[model samples]
Target: MTTPTAQTASSLRAAGREPPLPFAVTLDDGRELVMLRVLRILPSKRIVGEAETAGSRMLAKLFIAPGSTRHWQRERQGIEALAAAGIPTPALRHAGELHGGGHVLLTDFLADAASLSDHWQAVAGLPASHADALAVLAPAFAMLGRMHAHGLVQDDLHLGNFLVSGGELMVIDGDAVRSLSPGQALQADQAAANFAILAAQLPAGWDEHIAPLIDAWRQDGEGLPTLDTAALRERITHTRDARLKDFLAKTLRDCTLFKAEKTFDRLTIAVRAEADELAEVLADPDAAIAHGSLLKDGGTCTVAKLEHGNRPLVIKRYNLKNTRHALSRAWRPSRAAHSWVEGHRLAFLGIATPAPLAMIEERAGPLRRRAWIINAWCPGEDLATHLAPYVDSGPPPAEAEALRTLFATLYRERISHGDMKATNLLWHDGHVVLIDLDAMQQHRSASSHARAWRRDRARLLRNWPTDSALWRWLDANLPPA
Candidate 1:
């Protein structure tokens, strides 16, 4: 943290700038709030951070945008509503205009608290029906139900908006909390629609396990509004589809999750969290690949293992082969970009894949040439090698269970791995991790997906002989077209 120094809101709002911490912004009351750690920022719009004003720590939200009073007022009103509606929220401690042209809002800070999103990570890999996973989520939905019963709704309902501190599950992000039809419980349709946004946060096909969670909601709900389970399911499917489209669209732009740069001569995008760790490699990928240990250096692609700090990374370069081949692929998105997006998609759906770190495309104007994708190295062996000993018999129970789980998710989401070769499946930590995702596709149409699913199933089974026990086992166990 930097020493406390006064900074102008105008200066900090310049294009893509942020105030250096720990910096002070004078409040309308003439007291200085010194921010020590930045949490999240929307460039020139607003900034959230940890701050102190007079020996007390609080979460400070500086609405530094050109017209921020309206937003600041919404935050204050929302917090007030939460208290009036008997919903738990951090007490509003400070609300005032910035010395310059913005506003400041501060609330009690819970240093030991964790967001539901953070807690959910621990049990997210477990089956959604597992008791532990349900326990973590049940309370969050119960809180939402209580809000609805009290005639309030969290417009942007997600796990992150709930905080667990001192054994209390408290609602947060007052800006998202608002009232509907004052003094009356939310109608069944209104409540279900709001709940759909929250329900869609879980993985697809977990809907069967969701009935129990609604009971948890009913326990806290007032007036006990009847919810149509079928309608809720339909709403969830549509919300999930819309969310997937929005997330994929964000992949090509600069956003919180990704740092992207597009130029006529080049295209570079990296997972924002990995930007500092992989800076050297992202700066000059080809140079790093040249110095790394080569895994495969011919054909349509080249793979290499590189040592970065204490970690190992795998980089794959999609070779141009010839000028003719480059021309054929010029106008379309590069294969590296496709792999990067698909990798994130799989990870988003809770499927296993090597964590994609970054991707770059060498371009001349609008035309693309060679490209490279960087991923965290997986220590597990490929299925072809790992299962070589079990060819005559079925694999171990753990391995079989992992494959079943992976394919179940793929089928539920209508995801098809175009290349289902044994080498593309890696056995990592008792889970099957998919790689070589350049041709992977998640279908939007059921009919098109059925056709693609058939081809994938056949290709996967082709890895073993027709009469082999392992092949027969998979042919029967795996989901069919």
Candidate 2:
């Protein structure tokens, strides 16, 4: 393909701008292809672009990294092999090294196709019935089973690598495809492993549908193994948990870190906020706290309402009561950190909570003086206040259902709000939003979870007092451990 000259490269890099579209690349056979849009940019100086030659649309992948020709060749071999085996994949048009030190591969572009990942997101957003969701996903399971029956294994098998077009599931990115024997079916163990890879990508809270999906897969192939649903569920859960932990670690590490120039104090903002404005607040937190509208002023902590960029927020300041308390909290993580992490954990688990904005901690040498956490202010009455009128008669059906959903989510995730008093829950948008995440935690041991669960229920019942109608209703309707 045509090499980018120094002048062209300079113009592309002007003002740190990306290369403009509708660029042209000439193949070794003197055919000129014009790229219309960039698809993806990979590490190692590789780019995939949507290109056109004559009147046909094509996908062109260019690799500029040294020794990329071998990789390109391997991908070509995979595509050819799968295509020869009657597997659906893009048709390869050309593969060759460019005049410069790079390589390029061209393939026919599948128009009107969406990646399985994108399709899943769209379907999940729709107000579709459970049957509709199953119909959409069942075909993907069948296709996966068929591939394993044919002894084809995709090393990087994820929803993103498959495409949905014209009511058919098509596999792409053939570079990772492997075959056991020329035509022999995969072994039972290999099939199970491949199935686990696909299962790990299913959306959370869909564990109930695993058996049905497995049945659908088995209907498509005769030689498939009889997968143990429980065993497979464990494997999928383990993989999903590991991936979530890694994602959370990376998110926290890469979040914006703000340092107060004058106080040498530090703050970390989880969500995007104006650095200068936030820094001003962190530099003199006491003054800001004093000026803001106070919500609570207790011996151990204080809460206030403040605004940034015309957006209201609630800031909770955890105070060190005495010299002993200050010394104890000096070299350890502040309560603000715990709240920040628990808030994110709840969000990740799909539980409703006020959005956490930022966390600030002040220290004197090795002694931490105080810490603060800021969250988006949500307008709603606390659950106890909201349910006061219904305590004697029990909540309305809709409200009762909402409460049951809240507890069900917590139970399914093995999470317990350490202080589950009704005041810590809010009635908003027809759902219960959890607050005061400083003590929220997920338990790994069933016994520990049961103990915390009992405590949570007891605290919740205290709001209703005695064996009131509301208490009786909750006792009947709340999910069991």
Best prediction by TM-score: 1
Candidate 1 structure lDDT: 0.88
**Model 2, range 315-415, lDDT digits (tens) per residue?**
89998888888888888878887888788777666567898766777756544568888788888789889999998999988788778877987987788
* Residue 391 of model 2, lDDT score: 84
Clashing pairs in 2: none
True lDDT of residue 177, candidate 2: 81
What is the model-wide C-alpha lDDT for candidate 2? Answer: 0.73
The weakest ten consecutive residues by lDDT in model 1 span 11-20
- The lDDT for every candidate, in the order shown, is 0.88, 0.73
CA deviation > 4 Å runs, candidate 2 = 1-113, 122-129, 155-158, 165-168, 173-176, 180-182, 203-205, 255-327, 334-336, 354-381, 427-431, 479-481
What is the C-alpha lDDT profile of model 1 across 1-481, one tens digit per residue? 5578787678778735356778898989988899898888888888898999888999999998888988899989889988988888888998999997899999998998899999999888887779999899999989888888888888888899999999999999888877886777899988998999999988875787779889988888878589989888999989978887898888878988888988887888888889878889988888999989999988789999999979999999999888889889899899999999999899878898999999999999888988999999998999989998998998889999998989988988989999999999999987899999999999989998899899999999989888888998898889976
Instruction: Record all residue pairs in model 1 with backbone atoms less than 3 Å apart, i.e. clashing.
Output: none
